[model samples]
Target: MNPKVKTGISAAQTGLKAVKIGKKALNLKKKLPGEKKKATQKALEKSAKKAAKQEQKTEKKQSCRQRNRRALKNTKGIGRIALAIWNRYF
Candidate 1:
């Protein structure tokens, strides 16, 4: 196998190990006592806020059609520079 593939496998293994550790910690937290209702409420609110932001970003990406406008603006700027150079040297 190629050395790059081996390196990638090793990195992935390390990431999986970290994820397992994180999951174990979360499990322990769930088992250990506390106000369960409050924890559940906070978790739900955090997830809702995250989902809202993701939806907003997706909507913006879908409808924010500014690429053509930006391209036109850039061409206008280049044309000005080109004209100035031509006027100065020609």
Candidate 2:
């Protein structure tokens, strides 16, 4: 394979992975953060709520990570498909 073509395919795969992460994060943020409220209180309850939100954020981050991983894996699979098509035609 041409080095330039390989570079282009890698860049495209990376861009697609980023898009997958962005979509996952946006969807997770929508699912979270809405029903929560802003309030002040004693130390323990405040800390607990803060912890919960932090956990949600962590989960969202992990979800994005998983989505990106899947996208990259799928990108490799698609690259093989493209190669197969190229071999068949040319």
Best lDDT among the predictions, by candidate number = 1
Residue 42 deviation, candidate 1, in Å? Answer: 0.1
TM-scores for all predictions: 0.37, 0.50
Q: What is the C-alpha lDDT of each candidate?
A: 0.65, 0.62
Model 2 misses residue 34 by how many Å? 32
Off by over 4 Å in 1: 1-34, 66-90
Report the C-alpha lDDT of model 1 over 1-61, residue by residue, as the tens digit.
5545754665576566556655755775677667874575467556555655665575456
RMSD of 2: 15.6
lDDT of 2 by residue, 1-90 (tens): 554575466557656655665565555555655433122223334555565566557656766777798899999999999999999999
